[model samples]
Target: MKSKKVKESVTIMTQIVLPNDTNPLGNLFGGQLLAWMDLASSVASKRHSEGIVVTASVNNVSFTTPIALGSVVTLEAKITRAFNTSMEVFVDVWVEDRSGKNRTKVNTAIYIFAAVDENGKKRQVPELIPETDEEKVRFEGAMRRREMSLILAGKLKPKQATQLRALFE
Candidate 1:
Protein backbone atom coordinates (compact mmCIF):
# COMPACT_ATOMS: atom_id res chain seq x y z
CA MET A 1 0.00 0.00 0.00
CA LYS A 2 1.09 3.51 -0.73
CA SER A 3 2.05 5.78 2.14
CA LYS A 4 -0.19 8.74 2.88
CA LYS A 5 0.60 12.03 4.52
CA VAL A 6 -1.29 12.93 7.70
CA LYS A 7 -2.29 16.28 6.26
CA GLU A 8 -4.05 14.60 3.38
CA SER A 9 -6.71 13.27 5.74
CA VAL A 10 -7.43 16.36 7.82
CA THR A 11 -11.10 17.29 8.26
CA ILE A 12 -12.65 20.37 9.74
CA MET A 13 -16.33 20.90 10.55
CA THR A 14 -18.08 23.90 12.06
CA GLN A 15 -21.58 24.14 13.45
CA ILE A 16 -23.56 26.60 15.48
CA VAL A 17 -24.98 25.20 18.69
CA LEU A 18 -28.76 25.60 18.37
CA PRO A 19 -31.29 25.34 21.17
CA ASN A 20 -32.10 21.80 20.21
CA ASP A 21 -28.46 20.86 20.48
CA THR A 22 -28.09 22.16 23.99
CA ASN A 23 -29.17 20.95 27.40
CA PRO A 24 -31.44 22.69 29.91
CA LEU A 25 -28.39 24.52 31.26
CA GLY A 26 -28.09 26.36 27.93
CA ASN A 27 -24.88 24.54 27.11
CA LEU A 28 -24.30 22.18 24.24
CA PHE A 29 -25.04 18.59 25.14
CA GLY A 30 -22.06 16.29 25.59
CA GLY A 31 -23.58 13.69 23.32
CA GLN A 32 -24.12 16.29 20.60
CA LEU A 33 -20.48 17.28 20.67
CA LEU A 34 -19.44 13.63 20.62
CA ALA A 35 -21.56 12.95 17.54
CA TRP A 36 -20.00 15.86 15.67
CA MET A 37 -16.53 14.74 16.66
CA ASP A 38 -17.24 11.22 15.47
CA LEU A 39 -18.47 12.50 12.11
CA ALA A 40 -15.38 14.64 11.61
CA SER A 41 -12.98 11.87 12.62
CA SER A 42 -14.70 9.33 10.39
CA VAL A 43 -14.28 11.65 7.42
CA ALA A 44 -10.58 11.95 8.15
CA SER A 45 -10.21 8.18 8.45
CA LYS A 46 -12.05 7.59 5.17
CA ARG A 47 -9.86 10.12 3.40
CA HIS A 48 -6.76 8.33 4.64
CA SER A 49 -7.92 4.83 3.78
CA GLU A 50 -10.00 5.76 0.72
CA GLY A 51 -12.62 3.30 1.89
CA ILE A 52 -15.46 2.89 4.37
CA VAL A 53 -14.37 3.19 7.98
CA VAL A 54 -16.22 2.27 11.14
CA THR A 55 -15.72 3.56 14.64
CA ALA A 56 -13.91 0.85 16.58
CA SER A 57 -13.54 2.77 19.82
CA VAL A 58 -13.80 6.28 21.22
CA ASN A 59 -11.56 7.40 24.05
CA ASN A 60 -12.68 9.58 26.92
CA VAL A 61 -13.94 13.06 26.07
CA SER A 62 -13.46 15.40 28.97
CA PHE A 63 -15.26 18.66 28.44
CA THR A 64 -13.01 21.38 29.82
CA THR A 65 -15.59 24.10 29.36
CA PRO A 66 -19.25 24.38 28.54
CA ILE A 67 -20.13 25.65 25.08
CA ALA A 68 -23.01 28.07 25.35
CA LEU A 69 -25.87 28.03 22.91
CA GLY A 70 -25.17 29.99 19.73
CA SER A 71 -21.49 29.30 20.03
CA VAL A 72 -19.86 28.14 16.82
CA VAL A 73 -18.27 24.78 17.50
CA THR A 74 -15.44 23.78 15.22
CA LEU A 75 -14.12 20.23 15.10
CA GLU A 76 -10.76 19.48 13.49
CA ALA A 77 -9.72 15.89 12.93
CA LYS A 78 -6.59 14.31 11.49
CA ILE A 79 -5.14 10.84 11.17
CA THR A 80 -2.53 10.34 13.88
CA ARG A 81 -1.42 6.81 13.01
CA ALA A 82 -2.31 3.80 10.91
CA PHE A 83 -1.92 0.22 12.18
CA ASN A 84 -2.80 -2.71 10.01
CA THR A 85 -6.49 -2.15 9.21
CA SER A 86 -7.18 0.49 11.87
CA MET A 87 -6.30 4.16 12.10
CA GLU A 88 -6.08 6.46 15.09
CA VAL A 89 -7.68 9.87 14.63
CA PHE A 90 -7.31 12.87 16.89
CA VAL A 91 -10.10 15.43 17.08
CA ASP A 92 -9.89 18.87 18.64
CA VAL A 93 -13.04 20.78 19.52
CA TRP A 94 -13.10 24.54 19.81
CA VAL A 95 -15.93 26.89 20.69
CA GLU A 96 -15.96 30.29 19.09
CA ASP A 97 -17.60 33.32 20.66
CA ARG A 98 -19.14 35.35 17.89
CA SER A 99 -19.38 38.50 19.91
CA GLY A 100 -15.87 38.28 21.32
CA LYS A 101 -14.43 36.81 18.12
CA ASN A 102 -12.42 34.37 20.16
CA ARG A 103 -12.08 30.64 20.09
CA THR A 104 -11.52 28.41 23.12
CA LYS A 105 -10.59 24.77 23.02
CA VAL A 106 -13.36 22.72 24.66
CA ASN A 107 -12.09 19.18 24.35
CA THR A 108 -9.93 16.70 22.48
CA ALA A 109 -10.96 13.17 21.61
CA ILE A 110 -9.21 10.08 20.23
CA TYR A 111 -11.14 7.83 17.93
CA ILE A 112 -10.03 4.54 16.43
CA PHE A 113 -11.52 3.64 13.08
CA ALA A 114 -11.29 0.37 11.21
CA ALA A 115 -11.25 0.54 7.45
CA VAL A 116 -13.42 -2.02 5.72
CA ASP A 117 -13.81 -3.21 2.18
CA GLU A 118 -17.12 -3.42 0.28
CA ASN A 119 -17.64 -6.87 1.77
CA GLY A 120 -17.41 -5.41 5.30
CA LYS A 121 -14.09 -7.09 5.99
CA LYS A 122 -11.28 -5.10 7.51
CA ARG A 123 -8.60 -4.05 4.99
CA GLN A 124 -5.07 -2.82 5.33
CA VAL A 125 -4.62 0.93 5.02
CA PRO A 126 -1.70 3.02 3.90
CA GLU A 127 0.89 3.99 6.47
CA LEU A 128 0.63 7.51 7.92
CA ILE A 129 3.56 9.81 7.36
CA PRO A 130 3.72 12.71 9.77
CA GLU A 131 5.13 15.88 8.23
CA THR A 132 4.37 18.47 10.90
CA ASP A 133 5.64 18.76 14.45
CA GLU A 134 2.18 18.27 15.92
CA GLU A 135 1.58 15.29 13.67
CA LYS A 136 4.86 13.75 14.76
CA VAL A 137 3.96 14.13 18.43
CA ARG A 138 0.55 12.54 17.96
CA PHE A 139 2.02 9.78 15.81
CA GLU A 140 4.41 8.81 18.59
CA GLY A 141 1.71 8.97 21.26
CA ALA A 142 -0.71 6.81 19.32
CA MET A 143 1.24 3.63 19.89
CA ARG A 144 1.17 3.96 23.66
CA ARG A 145 -2.48 4.93 23.61
CA ARG A 146 -3.38 1.96 21.44
CA GLU A 147 -1.59 -0.37 23.78
CA MET A 148 -3.57 0.98 26.72
CA SER A 149 -6.80 0.60 24.78
CA LEU A 150 -6.03 -3.01 23.91
CA ILE A 151 -5.17 -3.84 27.49
CA LEU A 152 -8.38 -2.23 28.74
CA ALA A 153 -10.40 -4.17 26.18
CA GLY A 154 -8.79 -7.46 27.25
CA LYS A 155 -7.30 -7.97 23.82
CA LEU A 156 -3.73 -7.37 24.94
CA LYS A 157 -1.81 -8.05 28.11
CA PRO A 158 -0.15 -5.20 29.97
CA LYS A 159 3.20 -6.95 29.68
CA GLN A 160 2.82 -7.05 25.92
CA ALA A 161 2.67 -3.27 25.67
CA THR A 162 6.35 -2.66 25.04
CA GLN A 163 5.82 1.01 24.22
CA LEU A 164 3.82 1.55 27.40
CA ARG A 165 6.29 -0.45 29.47
CA ALA A 166 9.10 1.75 28.26
CA LEU A 167 7.17 4.82 29.35
CA PHE A 168 6.84 3.56 32.95
CA GLU A 169 10.25 1.96 33.28
Candidate 2:
Protein backbone atom coordinates (compact mmCIF):
# COMPACT_ATOMS: atom_id res chain seq x y z
CA MET A 1 0.00 0.00 0.00
CA LYS A 2 1.12 3.53 -0.67
CA SER A 3 2.30 5.61 2.26
CA LYS A 4 0.09 8.48 3.36
CA LYS A 5 1.09 11.87 4.69
CA VAL A 6 -0.04 12.92 8.16
CA LYS A 7 -1.77 16.00 6.76
CA GLU A 8 -3.84 13.79 4.46
CA SER A 9 -5.52 12.18 7.46
CA VAL A 10 -6.08 15.32 9.51
CA THR A 11 -9.58 15.82 10.89
CA ILE A 12 -10.93 18.97 12.49
CA MET A 13 -14.22 19.46 14.31
CA THR A 14 -15.75 22.51 15.98
CA GLN A 15 -18.53 22.66 18.54
CA ILE A 16 -20.22 25.15 20.80
CA VAL A 17 -20.63 23.94 24.33
CA LEU A 18 -24.30 23.84 25.30
CA PRO A 19 -26.12 23.63 28.59
CA ASN A 20 -26.96 20.00 28.00
CA ASP A 21 -23.30 19.20 27.44
CA THR A 22 -22.12 20.86 30.60
CA ASN A 23 -21.91 19.62 34.18
CA PRO A 24 -23.38 21.21 37.27
CA LEU A 25 -20.24 23.31 37.49
CA GLY A 26 -21.28 24.96 34.22
CA ASN A 27 -18.27 23.53 32.42
CA LEU A 28 -18.21 21.08 29.55
CA PHE A 29 -18.45 17.51 30.80
CA GLY A 30 -15.40 15.32 30.50
CA GLY A 31 -17.37 12.48 28.94
CA GLN A 32 -18.80 14.80 26.32
CA LEU A 33 -15.35 15.99 25.31
CA LEU A 34 -14.10 12.40 25.17
CA ALA A 35 -16.92 11.42 22.84
CA TRP A 36 -16.09 14.28 20.51
CA MET A 37 -12.41 13.37 20.53
CA ASP A 38 -13.22 9.75 19.78
CA LEU A 39 -15.32 10.66 16.78
CA ALA A 40 -12.71 13.03 15.40
CA SER A 41 -9.83 10.60 15.87
CA SER A 42 -11.81 7.75 14.33
CA VAL A 43 -12.32 9.79 11.20
CA ALA A 44 -8.59 10.48 11.02
CA SER A 45 -7.78 6.79 11.46
CA LYS A 46 -10.26 5.82 8.77
CA ARG A 47 -8.72 8.32 6.40
CA HIS A 48 -5.26 6.89 7.00
CA SER A 49 -6.43 3.29 6.80
CA GLU A 50 -8.81 3.81 3.89
CA GLY A 51 -11.22 1.40 5.56
CA ILE A 52 -13.40 0.89 8.59
CA VAL A 53 -11.72 1.52 11.92
CA VAL A 54 -12.55 0.89 15.55
CA THR A 55 -11.16 2.56 18.64
CA ALA A 56 -8.76 0.21 20.41
CA SER A 57 -7.64 2.32 23.31
CA VAL A 58 -7.50 5.81 24.76
CA ASN A 59 -3.96 6.01 25.96
CA ASN A 60 -4.11 9.41 27.53
CA VAL A 61 -6.32 12.42 28.19
CA SER A 62 -5.32 15.68 29.82
CA PHE A 63 -7.97 18.20 30.81
CA THR A 64 -5.94 21.32 31.28
CA THR A 65 -8.70 23.91 31.40
CA PRO A 66 -12.42 24.00 31.98
CA ILE A 67 -14.53 24.94 28.98
CA ALA A 68 -17.32 27.31 29.91
CA LEU A 69 -20.83 26.86 28.61
CA GLY A 70 -21.34 28.42 25.17
CA SER A 71 -17.61 28.34 24.56
CA VAL A 72 -16.42 27.47 21.07
CA VAL A 73 -14.35 24.30 21.15
CA THR A 74 -12.29 22.93 18.34
CA LEU A 75 -10.78 19.48 18.02
CA GLU A 76 -7.91 18.69 15.71
CA ALA A 77 -6.91 15.05 15.19
CA LYS A 78 -4.18 13.52 13.08
CA ILE A 79 -2.54 10.14 12.72
CA THR A 80 0.82 10.23 14.43
CA ARG A 81 1.95 6.82 13.30
CA ALA A 82 0.67 3.70 11.56
CA PHE A 83 1.65 0.18 12.53
CA ASN A 84 0.77 -3.10 10.85
CA THR A 85 -2.94 -2.91 11.59
CA SER A 86 -3.28 0.00 13.96
CA MET A 87 -2.64 3.71 14.15
CA GLU A 88 -1.93 6.21 16.92
CA VAL A 89 -3.86 9.48 16.80
CA PHE A 90 -3.31 12.72 18.66
CA VAL A 91 -6.21 15.03 19.37
CA ASP A 92 -5.75 18.59 20.53
CA VAL A 93 -8.70 20.51 21.93
CA TRP A 94 -8.79 24.28 21.88
CA VAL A 95 -11.20 26.85 23.30
CA GLU A 96 -11.65 29.88 21.09
CA ASP A 97 -11.79 33.44 22.35
CA ARG A 98 -15.05 35.40 22.27
CA SER A 99 -13.92 37.11 19.10
CA GLY A 100 -12.92 33.74 17.62
CA LYS A 101 -9.60 35.25 16.76
CA ASN A 102 -7.39 33.26 19.13
CA ARG A 103 -7.51 29.78 20.59
CA THR A 104 -6.30 28.39 23.90
CA LYS A 105 -5.41 24.73 24.15
CA VAL A 106 -7.58 23.18 26.83
CA ASN A 107 -7.10 19.47 26.43
CA THR A 108 -5.06 16.82 24.66
CA ALA A 109 -5.58 13.11 24.09
CA ILE A 110 -3.93 10.08 22.53
CA TYR A 111 -6.02 7.32 20.96
CA ILE A 112 -5.29 4.03 19.26
CA PHE A 113 -7.42 2.55 16.47
CA ALA A 114 -7.39 -0.64 14.50
CA ALA A 115 -8.41 -0.96 10.89
CA VAL A 116 -10.94 -3.69 10.23
CA ASP A 117 -12.53 -5.36 7.24
CA GLU A 118 -16.15 -6.36 6.49
CA ASN A 119 -15.90 -9.37 8.76
CA GLY A 120 -14.33 -7.32 11.54
CA LYS A 121 -10.90 -8.82 11.09
CA LYS A 122 -7.92 -6.56 11.51
CA ARG A 123 -6.63 -5.16 8.22
CA GLN A 124 -3.29 -3.77 7.19
CA VAL A 125 -2.89 -0.01 7.09
CA PRO A 126 -0.62 2.08 4.96
CA GLU A 127 2.57 3.49 6.42
CA LEU A 128 2.38 7.10 7.68
CA ILE A 129 4.82 9.77 6.55
CA PRO A 130 5.18 12.66 8.94
CA GLU A 131 6.12 15.98 7.35
CA THR A 132 6.33 18.71 9.97
CA ASP A 133 8.78 18.80 12.88
CA GLU A 134 5.93 18.27 15.33
CA GLU A 135 4.67 15.32 13.37
CA LYS A 136 8.12 13.78 13.27
CA VAL A 137 8.48 14.20 17.01
CA ARG A 138 5.13 12.52 17.59
CA PHE A 139 6.00 9.71 15.22
CA GLU A 140 9.26 9.01 17.00
CA GLY A 141 7.60 8.95 20.41
CA ALA A 142 4.81 6.58 19.30
CA MET A 143 6.91 3.46 19.73
CA ARG A 144 7.76 4.29 23.32
CA ARG A 145 4.16 5.10 24.10
CA ARG A 146 2.93 1.89 22.47
CA GLU A 147 5.36 -0.15 24.48
CA MET A 148 4.27 1.47 27.71
CA SER A 149 0.61 0.82 26.89
CA LEU A 150 1.27 -2.82 26.13
CA ILE A 151 3.30 -3.26 29.28
CA LEU A 152 0.61 -1.70 31.44
CA ALA A 153 -2.00 -3.95 29.84
CA GLY A 154 0.18 -7.05 30.47
CA LYS A 155 0.23 -7.67 26.73
CA LEU A 156 3.99 -7.20 26.63
CA LYS A 157 6.66 -8.08 29.13
CA PRO A 158 8.66 -5.16 30.42
CA LYS A 159 11.90 -6.84 29.35
CA GLN A 160 10.58 -7.13 25.83
CA ALA A 161 9.90 -3.41 25.52
CA THR A 162 12.99 -2.31 23.69
CA GLN A 163 11.72 1.19 23.16
CA LEU A 164 11.08 1.62 26.85
CA ARG A 165 14.38 0.06 27.81
CA ALA A 166 16.15 2.58 25.62
CA LEU A 167 15.16 5.24 28.10
CA PHE A 168 17.37 3.70 30.79
CA GLU A 169 20.27 2.69 28.60
Residue pairs with backbone atoms closer than 3 Å in model 2 (clashes): none
lDDT of 1: 0.92
- The list of candidate 1 runs beyond 4 A from truth reads 166-169
Candidate 1 C-alpha lDDT tens digits along 36-147: 9999999999999999999999997798798999999899999999999999999998888868589888899999999999999999999999998999999999998999
What tens-digit string does per-residue lDDT give for candidate 2 at 102-128? 789888899999999999999999999
Residue pairs with backbone overlap in model 1:
none
